[model samples]
Target: MYLFTACCVLCGEKVKANISLCEPCLQDLPRISCCCYRCGLPLKNQLNDTLCGQCQQSLPPIDYLISSLHYAYPVGHLVSQLKFQHHLVHAKIFAQLLLTTLQTHSLYHSIPLPDIIIPVPLHKKRLRQRGFNQALEIARPISETLDIPISTGLIRRAKYTQAQSLLNAVERRKNLRHSFALIKPISAGHIVLIDDVVTTGTTVYELANLLKKQGVKTVGVWAVARATHHYK
Candidate 1:
């Protein structure tokens, strides 16, 4: 039998079977350790609380947030390549990273495995322009690996809003107002929302609100990366 070697998607360094990043690159990755359990934002002093000050004051619509990496450096670059440059390999790499994170979290935390995965939808116009939904692309491999089905038609982006990254928190919220609509009734008790990166989180908040309105009991977010305060 012949053997095969894999190369790191980011550094192009040869890696062992079923992995992407080299040891140095993997060590350099900005994995989130101490973070708010609700929003997954990195915390300065974790202390006794799993939530940050903002979350303690007011909880987000989401029940839990699971993010693998911080939206910085190489992670950001990889997301950009998948989102803008149409490099599908990056999406596969991201899905693999997310799978690893979920497996690790399941060891210690009682993270509920979702009944179904719903990738944040894109507007039809945007989908036509881009030729692919990055969220769905990122979710495909994850769904396959985790044995969770993905539903692309459960939620629809009704409004063609401006990019969330270009707007402030208030503007982002306003932009997404009435932007998403549930396409059908959801029977799943637990649902996982998949996204490439979560910034101010206004987008997911809006989506979560809609899902809850439709009687989705639990809404969890699974993102490849989470934005830091500096980026937000």
Candidate 2:
């Protein structure tokens, strides 16, 4: 018999099977301590109130947002490697981290669990080019851990739009208009939308609008990372 060993992707330290992170790397992962509860944008001050200035001025479409990490430092590097390089090991690490955060974070623990998880869909052309939907890959482990079924066929990207990271907030919103459509009827009361990262939140907002129209009362977002500011 052969024994297999796994090492932490970040530190190269030995780890148990089925996990990519050692204790140190897991503890060192960039976490979002304070953020807007509505959109998950990192905040400067730690206050009792969860909404940021922008969220207070204009409420987000989604009922709530829960993100595990900030899009900075090593977390951003890991995401880039996973998304562009197809390093699926990073996806597993992300999913595991997200699950741990959801289970332990007081804010997330208080919120009601979603009935089903729906990963943000990729356009067919982009999906083919990438060979996999990063969101879907990230969602699988979360689904298994939470015992919630993931629904991928309910919604689809009807139009291929430019990547959100490449556009400003205004352009991102404009680009995503009418980009997604509901393919089949959804019966879930509360649905959680999963994505790798939330930059401008335009993509999730557009998709949430479609899900809300289908009578999903509570639409929440679960992402690996949340961008504090808009990307250039």
Candidate 3:
């Protein structure tokens, strides 16, 4: 149990909640309803493959991506606080919301629940500065709730790249190329990539590529939020 004193980003009222943002803020968060099923980008209609325009042109390495909420308004501010302001506790709240969203979404039954939850790895330098990986912070509670095993050391960030926010789509892909390596056998089972947010998805795509190379069959992207509109 935790208490949050910060004002809600949506209604701007001081309130208590599991996360920093209040219930109204959470209720007001934007979501992606009209998006490709495979890659999670905007789409007018669901196709056979359910891949977006960019995804149809050249598929991302991952098979599918599932996001809980849109990366906008209070949700975006929550992410910024977790990443930059060091409010890592907010990740638990985000994970709870993710679980609730999954329960309501039909997509939940389409894929097998991952045998293991693997958080996107952070470079040693960044981990040292932040004192924690935001992805891992979110993954902890999710694992506990779902009773899924979590492997922290199985994946490693090979090197640090420039901020993904500063890079264009092409640059983002190039930046994350060879960025993640599986240090051990991740077990031959469904894998769920856990992260705080998905923008370009280059990070999760590369990780899925690495996982497939490591002998994992099914890989799915699970993020707290998805940036439907991004700078890059």
The candidate that achieves the highest lDDT relative to the unseen native structure: 2
Report the lDDT tens digits of candidate 1 across residue range 23-56: 7888889987667888878776673138887898
Question: What lDDT score is found at residue 213 in candidate 3?
Answer: 85
Candidate 1 displacement at residue 68 in angstroms: 0.6
- Ranked candidates (lDDT, high to low): 2, 1, 3
Q: lDDT per residue, candidate 3, 1-232, as tens digits?
A: 4335477644667767555567766666786666677776645555424667676688777777777778877788878888888875577678877787767666678667888988999999888988888888888888888899888889899888888878898999889988877777767568888998888888888888899888888888778888775335
Query: What lDDT does candidate 1 reach at residue 216?
Result: 90
Candidate 2 to truth, TM = 0.92
Off by over 4 Å in 2: 1-5, 16-18, 47-49, 230-232
Which pairs of residues collide in candidate 1?
A: none
What's the distance in Å from true for residue 4, model 3? Answer: 5.3
Off by more than 4 A, model 3: 1-21, 44-49, 229-232
- Tell me each candidate's TM-score: 0.91, 0.92, 0.88
**lDDT by residue (tens digit), candidate 2, 1-232:** 1112398888888987566788877778788887788888888776424787788899878988888888888988898888899888888878877897788766666767889999999999999999999899999988987899999889999999887777888899899999999898999999999999999899899988998898989999999999877454
**Which residue window of length 10 is worst by lDDT in model 2?**
1-10
TM-score: which candidate is best? 2
Candidate 1 lands at a TM-score of 0.91
| Candidate that beats the other on TM-score, 2 or 3, i.e. the better one | 2
